[model samples]
Target: MDAWVSHAGIFSATIKFNEPLQVAWVNTSGDQVTPGSFSLDPLKVKSKRAYINQTVPFTIADEAAFSAFTSAMITQPNFTWHLTSDKLDVRALAFPTAHGLHFKKDVTLNGMNNFGRARLARRLQAARDDPAGGIVFSATTGLDNSSAFNVNLGTGSGANTVIKPGSNAVTLDGRLVPQTGTDALATTFELFTKYLNGEQADVVATGKSSIQADGRAVSWLSAGLTALELHVPFVAPGGAVSPIKAITIGDMSLEFSTHAPWAPVSNSRTVLAAMELPFGFGLEIEEISNRGRCRACQLDG
Candidate 1:
């Protein structure tokens, strides 16, 4: 008898910016300029990573949405473009069929600018007048990878700030690692307990998550502690048991840290922002049985 293993599932996630991000633009004079701090809307993503080396990509192209926000900022006479802080904070929630997980990640990067081109200035002017004619920028990060680098931000180092022409292309690359803290885990436990006790109705109603399994909606009081574990069995040929051929399992884990004003206090149910929870699954194959029966098997038959 021979058997094969399989695992499949889906996940829904919501990402939100926890704090205002400073924005800056530079002119041809090479001087750093400060625009104003801006906040982004929440983004919802649904994806599945059933194999290793798979990456999830997202893009936004709503010029009108950005134009409406920036138009109001430009009206302020005191508005200057500049990065207010060196750190960025974001919060994320991942609700998969396996479990409900949360993450908080803090990214610190040296600010740089490249908006010094006549063409770029013209494009900026056009973008201000036309809702469909704004700029588009993108960024990507390794969900399950890490890297290291040494950087110097002091004046005289040409690498201190990023530069780009106004009408040209720009790409910024840097290492971003998860922040260190215990608040995310504490929140996860609290939420799990709430889910197990039928107190997650408010969480679900807020459009934060929907918990279900086996093609049916699931409640905390109904699943108990086993809500996190999902199992599926495969029967062997001829109802006979033999050595396992393969094994596949899903891996779901959380990584995050909390800072002042965002961290939860004792007995508080507040969830922190600035987290990354990269969850996925993979398979491993073991020994393969021979086409012909082994001596022990033949004798038994």
Candidate 2:
């Protein structure tokens, strides 16, 4: 049996993903001169030769997770091109049109609550009365009949969620864009190598990431990737709401984990198991590392 878990009030915040797409060029016959890569002439022949011919063109793809119900998407800190098309044609600009581009996404909290609470009062009651007296709780959620704790909560409108009462208004503001071709990736790699060097591979940039590879070497110049940065926001209850207190049945304490998987679409095949707190619980977010997995939990006193 499952217990009813409800949010005392609305949760809201803005989540930013600073995932930067990088490009790097390797395996060059010459000294491997990058766009702005050069050394001072011994004789001081040319102060700045501007070896712009050796540069490449690329773009980065940045994305944010936003509410699907939003009527419009907002672009924060819009990106601009510093070099003109004429500069690109004449090779006056080192990056030119061939330079790399990076696109990012950010999601804002716009809904009162991300999800509604689920109640398991009936199931728990049934389990308590069962003659066998064998009731165990499991976090794994799926449709398999073999599991004892496989509670079916229904689908679509019938699906259970964590609902908050007050301030029913909120929104998740973020961006989503497609990034293709090797040109952009290559350039991105180059920038990455220059900024951090080979010794610092774990240095995370501004955004969360999830990069996938085609199973082939991207370049001998850089490391291969499967997927990078898939970040979600940490939620905290706001507005008028009572603090959630731990629920207890007899001497046994009731608790659940809140760091659950987030899949925005309702019809998607993937299953979600949210960490549910007792009714009137408040939300809080803990800062975590930007790279790899970014997870948070909902707790009660």
Candidate 3:
């Protein structure tokens, strides 16, 4: 392999937050999941290229526990996270300008021909006449491929727009990713665990080319029997023959998962032995806090 590679560039990405859910606790002794597991939101975050920046608030049953939990969460190896803002209504740009744009003035402009440029000019004129034309945009951006959504300037699709309330910051990355592998999964999980434990790890962060553990890192991780999911684009074996048929395989998935013991702490804390089961590949530990009670107090009188 050549040690001196040329350079890096920007990439497109897709993100999704599935409906909130909780994993049923399985006693390490049984084959089935325990029904009495605590109810909590196990955040499911999936993104291609990079993970988005989000701020979520952590609530605790007691004020004292809040600090411990927050501290542990910011430092635990078992929990998954991304920071949350106190004001849920605040909007942050999903794509930051300084970090998001990647230029390649030299790479052969693929599908865009002279005719396409002309058509784009006409479309731009039409857009200017539209109500939301003033939003910031780059003339060099690649066209939006998914026609499923009718995006306008303000609607904010491929074009970069100003960060506003409810706006989110997402990281876009471009690199050769493998489909699936055990060694890869193990290594990735180790990094993820370290990240949750407030340790440094290589995570594709949004807006920035790469993000380091800022000592305040918060990103979501998925739980799966075998692997967690990741989003990515694919190029079919044969390139598209027609511009209309430019089959840029976007949003294909990548998955990884883990199994560890969890303490169900509501008004009180309950601990169970670690559940050793088949890799359920989609189990995620969203928030793990450290609450200290006298060990003697936890024992039966």
The lDDT values for all models are 0.27, 0.22, 0.25
lDDT of 1 by residue, 1-301 (tens): 0111122224444444455445553323545444344454444444532222212221223333233223322222122333343333223343333222332223322221111111111111101122343222211211110111111111211223222212222222211122245996576556434433434212111011123333332222122212112111111112232234453324322222344332322221232233221111121337432222112211132
> How does each model score on TM-score?
0.17, 0.14, 0.16
What is model 2's C-alpha RMSD?
Answer: 28.7
Report the alpha-carbon TM-score of model 1 versus the true structure: 0.17
Query: Which 10-residue window in model 2 sums to the lowest lDDT?
Result: 65-74
Query: Ranking under TM-score, best-scoring first?
Result: 1, 3, 2
Q: Please identify model 2 stretches exceeding 4 Å from their true place.
A: 1-32, 35-210, 216-301
Q: Per-residue lDDT of 203-274 in model 2, one digit per residue for the tens?
A: 221212212232232221111111112122211212122333343223322233344433121222232323
- Return whichever of 1 and 3 wins on lDDT: 1
The candidate that wins on lDDT is 1
- lDDT for model 3 comes to 0.25
lDDT of 1 at 24: 50
Provide the clashing-pair count of each candidate structure: 20, 64, 40
Residue 231, model 1, lDDT: 17
